[model samples]
Structure formats: structure tokens, C-alpha cells
Target: MIGLNLRLHWIYVPYLSSGRSIRLQINTVIMNPNLDDVDRKILRELQTDGRASFRDISSRIGVSTPTVSARVQAMTDMGLIKGYSTLLDADMLGQVSVILTINAKPSHLEDVYERLMEDEMVRQIFILSDSRLLCMLSFYNQVKYKMFIETISKIPEILSMDASMILKAPKENQRAALTDEAGLLIRCYYCGHMIHDEGVKIKMDGKYHYLCCPVCSKLYKEKYEKLRKSA
Candidate 1:
């Protein structure tokens, strides 16, 4: 959480249901997170439900939607909310999803993302400040876990990677705080798409509504303009 003063390559990308893929340049986006209690609360609520309407967040936070919107915008401008993701029923999806902790060569962290990102089955991955790594990956449940582990072990940069099956609670639960980048990436400024960083990703400006990007912001302005004139 601290000392990310180091520059990183962060990439914004799209999540596709049709099996289409988009390659992204992963930059280490330093999160200079500054939060008040309300900002934290807004994040908590949003984390629970990415699609929660702005009206709902405003009501819960006891502020007007515009005020909630303003604060969310400010937080996003500051890079607090990294993304939002849909919590999928991995088992239902018929692919085996498990948590893998990799202790690849510390210097090889970038290489890990570079090589690992090439695999479509690799869902979500993270790099630890302590030079360790953790990833959530899903493939055929029928495939032996060790076989997959062995395949990765072949990577010259991988020091050691261990993976285990994770059990999902029947109901949703909050993960203990490690860091808070995941909550902000839910809003997209383009095409009104809302993504939960379930696997792929996008970017944000979210108090209650999602801001896709600068272009989407302009599109929103024009969209409302057309609406106003038509009315």
C-alpha cells in the first residue's frame, strides 16, 4: 500500500463474454489513496454491488446524488477506486478456479504478468509489494492441478508457484482488506458498459455512477444534450 512511489504499467481493458480477447499494457498505477469515512463507506457499498444505482448510494450516504457523484469523481481522480467486478459462480461455469500463490523471481514480476497475461484462462492476478504473487485462475476442472502448476513452473522466471482449490461461500462475503484498488474499476466511460473486475478490467469515476473514460465523459455530455433537445 505504501512505497508504490515506484512507477508501474497499469492497463485498462475490456472483459468479453464472447471469448474475444484484448491485450493490455499493464502499468503499475500507483494508488495514492486518500479517503474520508464517507468515501470509504461509499466504496464499501459499491463493493457489495457494482450496479447499485446512484440514487441508492445517495440515500444510504444521506447525500444528494450530485454530491455523492462529486465525491466519487474526486476519489476516482485521485485513483482510489481501481475497478468493479461481477462475482461469478465459478463452479457453475464448469471451469476449475483456484487460488495460486507464486513466488517467482522478485525481479521477474513484470515478466510474470507479461507471460501469464497471454493465457486466456488466467482470470485475475496480483503482485505483492513483498515480492510474492497471488492469482486466481480457472481452467477445466478435469485437468490435474499439478499439471498446470508444472506448466507454469517451466517459466524461467517462476521461482515457486503453489495453487489450491478455494471454496466459495453460498452467499457473498467481503474479503479482509489488503488494499482497495478493486472497488473503483467498475465504471466505464465508453458504451455504458459496467464491468466487475471478475477477470478482465476497465476504468472509473464512481460515486454512484460509472465513468468510463474521457471520451465516454464527452459522449455522456452529448447524450444528455440530445435528450434535452428532444424533450
Candidate 2:
């Protein structure tokens, strides 16, 4: 069973269609900085109310407004904070939810994955251990659901698919309890490599940037300065 304390977040890509985008979630742990007291406090506040202003969070946490703002921005740049979203009552909206377990041949997995990404009803997708995919799909009614099934059935890459409807969600969108041990996944801004140690850190444009080495730091700084100068 998944623990309630584990944070569920999505990393969004550039592919957008029909006012919806494909989101990929990372399930494995990555090495980075652990959360501090102030960081935890700010995340907790925002998790409770995403729309809370930085001033309100500062007052509640007994920190200055500027500090709250800076921390939030830094976290956002670091990808620790993915993005904000509003919760909606799917039941009231007459939306049907289903979980799809999909299996594709090794040679055609990417083809099948791309086809699914074009579907607006496909909300979330997870790559499983055995090279299968677990997808969450939403639809307005049975008619649309049947249509989607028929459409995907024509795809040759998808070997098999199993679907299970979600009848009810007893606890949905549970907030992650930010603890001191919680770590942020850091990556090199220049080389796009994961930083496993105390990597180089530099502040530019009022935001902190991480690099895996001194060489990367130098290169990233030069590139950033060039971009800024051109701008």
C-alpha cells in the first residue's frame, strides 16, 4: 500500500492539446537537499490552501512575506513545486473515472504511448516494472467511453488493455506531509544530469541554480549571461 505521507506530484511536458496536457509522475527517489523547518512550514501552508497569498502564509508561519515569496519561487524553480490546481467534484460533474492497464510489445511500446498521449481523456499514465502502462482515463458518459475504447482498439501497437472503473474515492488529493527528511530532486541546469552530492549552487536572476560540477557551473553561467545580455 502507498503511504499517505508520500507526496504525489506530476511533471508536465510541452505536449498540449484540447486544453489538456500529458503529465508524467516520477515514483522513484532522487538524491537532493532535505527540507528545512521553514521549507516544511511553507509547503504545509500551501498544501492546505494553494490559493493562500504569500503574505497570509508569512503571517501564519511567523515569517516575513519576502522570505515566503522567495522560498516559494526557489522551490518552484527547483521543480519541488510542480504547479497548482483546483479540486473538482467529478461525481457532481457526471464524469466517469476508469483505470486502464495496458500492455504493448517491446518494439511498439513508444508508438502506443504516443497514441495514448493524444487522447484528451487520458489524465495520468504510469510506466510499470514489467514494461506495462497504468493509465487513468476520464469521460463524460458511457457513449464517449465506448467510442474511446473502439478508437484504441484499432491501434496495432497495444497488445492488450484492461479497465476498471473507480466507483468512489474515499480520500482523494491527500496532501503530502512535509517532513525534515523529505528531499528535493535536483538536476544540473546545464547538463541535465541528476546531482547526487553537494553540487555547485549559483544565484542568478533572483533564483538559485544548481550544477553538477564547477565546469558545468561555469558553462551555465556563461550561457545565462549571454541570454540575459541579448535580452
Number of the top TM-score candidate: 2
lDDT of 2 by residue, 47-122 (tens): 8999999999999999999989988886786678889999888889999999999988888887888889998999
Clashing pairs in 2: none
- lDDT tens string, model 1, 1-231? 111233434344455565565555433323333345567767777877789887899999887898678776656653565566677776787777788888877778888878888877777778877677788788776466657677888888887767787666466465546244433344354474753322122233332323333344444555756876899
Write down the worst ten-residue block by lDDT for model 1.
198-207
Clashes of each: 23, 0
Model 1 Cα shift for residue 13 (angstroms) = 39
Evaluate model 1: give its TM-score: 0.53
